[model samples]
Target: MAKQKTAFVCTECGSDYRKWQGQCNDCGTWNTLSEVRLGSSGGSGAASARSSALSGRRGGFAGAVPESRLLDDIDCEDVARFTSGTGEFDRVLGGGLVPGSAILVGGSPGAGKSTLLLQTLCHLARTMPCLYVTGEESLQQVAMRARRLGLPTDQLRLMSETHLESMLAALDEHRPRVVVIDSIQVVHSDEIASAPGSVSQVRECAAALTRFAKQSGTVLLLVGHVTKDGSLAGPKVLEHMIDCSILLEGSDDSRFRTLRGQKNRFGAVNELGIFAMTDGGLREVRNPSAIFLDRSDEVAAGSAVMVVWEGTRPLLVEIQALVDESQLGNPRRVAVGLEQNRLAMLLAVLHRHGGLQVGDQDVFANVVGGVKVLETSADLALLMAIVSSFRDRVLPRDMVIFGEVGLSGEIRPVPSGQERLAEAAKHGFRRALVPKANAPKHAIPGMQVIPVGKLGEALDALEQ
Candidate 1:
């Protein structure tokens, strides 16, 4: 019998090394290498058989050889998609779930990853075959939750299993149109020598399942665990294997959850979905702007409203800034749901162009309702909010602002500027401060459009 070989692997980047080292040379991460046992040189019969099954080969070429064709000559028909029974969920998946595609959903515990899938599967099972396999929870527990939620449990098939071979066999037998693996971390392959959730085990199991999905034309939904730092647990290669990767984000205490797509082959990766946790289950937020713009009637000095384009629509969110005299030698610059470095750079621009200085003050900024503002369109709103707070002046509550401020004090226009302004106007915003290039040709019915080319001009308009 040939001796089994051992190799070191980096948990961060999934790079294999011959031996363990103090740091991973590939990812530049320290102390992330772990030892993994490789299959013997001779290879066990079971391992070979499993490998053949996964690859759909029987010791030789299994199908006819392929031929290359011109890119334009190839068929370019649109792929069919079926709704996931939830509009928000479907929106994040480009339009709907496509056949023969694998999607990985990841989130921290209690973030409603399982709840959302369960609800969607239950509704979808009525139209087509669906299977729900759980490796973490018992069948009784899942049934109890389904009963409590008043879901249509009769159509959805449930199975409790962890062995990869058995799960694959069940998939073959049931032949469901849609299959949900409660989680990939808990599923272990019989051929692997390592424990479940290990780097090797996760890689092999996911590869096998994805291959099956591709061949069988099944919509595969995988639930993935997240590390403490809020990234998907397991090898980074797992993300590369799937067609789409989405993250469900929210604190356990918060009722609102945000689903953001990190990667997608069929849809836009920048799409954002909003859901509210309730006794029934996760319900979609049709009008997210209203929920995110919920503010008190009394006007505040540091509060400002901004229109941000998210995915296919526009969102109205409130931006707040507080500037106070520094109590310590080094003034603290903190940002919640916003970038810290951006706040510093925006401050410098304000000082140079707008003639406002708060270098000695502690600056804190936040986006209301926990919505992360990634676009530079919020720059003008942030600057205006900071200025209002420093001067103890209250801006008009009906005013909306969205534009990008350059280092040279010029205001840059954002994409879909007219749509953003229209959305704000729909929400009853009377005044809009935007970039000159983004200004509409004709005036809106109830809104006043103020277009500014430089930072100094914006400050002048604010005074008026």
Candidate 2:
């Protein structure tokens, strides 16, 4: 029998080596190298067969192109964007999908990643023909999901196959305008003798499909699986191969989903798309501040309003906190999505400088609407709410509090204070505890805007 051909492959970067190495040469990840069979023909045969025309007399290798020549400008309008049928999805992608762009969508199981894509295709197929390829589930499964979505279009075609070589051949024959792969994990290639979802197969399949999409000038949407820790699965090169990558995130309750762009060659990265989970599908939430506010007849203590900036948008969220005596040596400062150590530090700041007896308290904080807050503008809100909750006092229902409490007991003006106030007012907040520096030159009627320079002043106003 002919000897089997194999090589050591780095699971992180997909770099192949003849001998095992302690660390990946490409990504510098340690202990990621594993042995993988390159099949009977080896990878060289596969590479030659795959790119025979490019490596021909044209000199397909990159060594031929000068570094300066590689930096040439590309057409902007021509490479603009493609409409995905969902307005929010379009917004997050910087208006639309780029022509011939390969985008990866990753999320947890049942996080509505697949549903969102299928809905998008159904909308696009109304004008353009689309093909959906699935390797893990059958065509019937896709059909069932479509029916549940009340979308059964004739232009929407589905294929169930794990063999990427066969899938590529079919794609060449069909030539659809848009292509969507249900997932990349289960897809494999015969060129590499490895189990499906392994590093080699995933890298090979992704490279092949990415090449095909770019060459054919077709837009491809790939649904990827996220690891348990929430990182995108597959080789690191997998993220590099695509033109765009969007991460869909939400709480386990399925009440909301947030689409954030980590990489976007078509537009700006860090763009955000918010969606509310409903029985129908993911509906984009345009003004999240309104949805997050809870206006009632009465105000309660230990409650405060905060502002957080997500990408380019500023949103107002309610912060609720409770404080009590600590039962253990280490007080518990628990935060759902926010950093726990940050909360502990804030508490310490309150005790040391703000004249708060919270050293022995078991304090907890929550950012409403199930979204995480990374901004410290909510610091004052958190402090006030915790104190109120401990005193069992009711805060004014129409009052909104937001500022950064300094160690010297001064109230620091938050960045984008005007915008935050506008959002709070739009949400029907009448009273606001704002930073003294952020106070407008001329006061507007109807709402009471109280500007304070110190945390003690704000506390006195709250007491009144």
Highest-lDDT candidate: 1
**In model 1, what is the error at residue 232, expressed in angstroms?**
1.0
Q: Write down the RMSD of candidate 1 (Cα, Å).
A: 2.8
Alpha-carbon TM-score of each model against the true structure: 0.94, 0.85
Once fitted onto the true fold, the runs of candidate 1 whose alpha carbons sit more than 4 angstroms away are: 3-7, 36-38, 43-66
lDDT by residue (tens digit), candidate 2, 1-464: 44677788776676878999798877899998877665566567667776865765232212133234343484434555668877789877878877677899999887889888888888888888788887777888888878877885677878888888898898999988889888889988877778988877877788788878877778888889998999888777788878899999987875889898889887777777889888777888877777777544466667777777666677777888877788999888888757787788777777776677877778888877777777778777887888789878877877888888777778898888777777777777899888899887776566789999987787788889
Best by TM-score: 1
How far residue 140's Cα lies from its native spot in candidate 2, in Å, is 1.3
How high is the CA lDDT of each candidate model? 0.92, 0.80
CA RMSD per model (angstroms) = 2.8, 4.0
